[model samples]
Target: MARVVVDVMLKPEILDPQGQAVQRALPRLGFEGIADVRQGKRFELDLEGPADEAALARIREIAGTFLANTVIEDFVVRVEEPAEAASADNNAEEGAVR
Candidate 1:
């Protein structure tokens, strides 16, 4: 199976109250030096086959039409490597850490 990731973010001109709230709280929680924060949404899709150009185009259309409001938001779609590859990478990292 192929994994497709869609990230939806508000336009630069749009105000993000939730993101602002998080930014404000970060200082109080002992985290600092963050200039700003913009919250966004993520959608992961598991497809039956590889993520080819056609699949990516279809996902882009879906993201623009259904996942994001084109007037106030923008979206990016990408394909992630298979879970087995990711797992192997994670295991390698763990081994290195130990």
Candidate 2:
């Protein structure tokens, strides 16, 4: 199986109140040195076949049309390697921070 990831983020000009709230709390929690934070959304899709050019194009279309708000947000779609996907799954199962 192939894993496709879609990441949706607000446009740089858009204000991110949620991200700003986290950034402000980070300092209170003793995590320092971060200049800024922008919260976003991630979508993972498992495909039955290879992630080829055609599949990528379809994914991009889906991302642009359904996954992101084109007026205020942008999205990127990518194929995730099996190893990397496995690692991320393991981390989630173990309650590790991303």
Clashing pairs in 2: none
Candidates' C-alpha lDDT: 0.89, 0.90
**Among all candidates shown, the one with the greatest lDDT:** 2
* lDDT (10s digit) by residue, model 2, range 1-98: 89999999999999999999999999999999999999999999888989999999999999998999989998989898877755665455635644
Q: Flag regions of model 2 displaced more than 4 Å.
A: 87-98
Clash pairs detected, candidate 1: none
Candidate closest to the true structure, highest TM-score: 2
Model 2 TM-score is 0.84
Q: Distance (Å) between predicted and true CA of 93, model 2?
A: 14
Model 1 vs truth, CA RMSD: 4.6
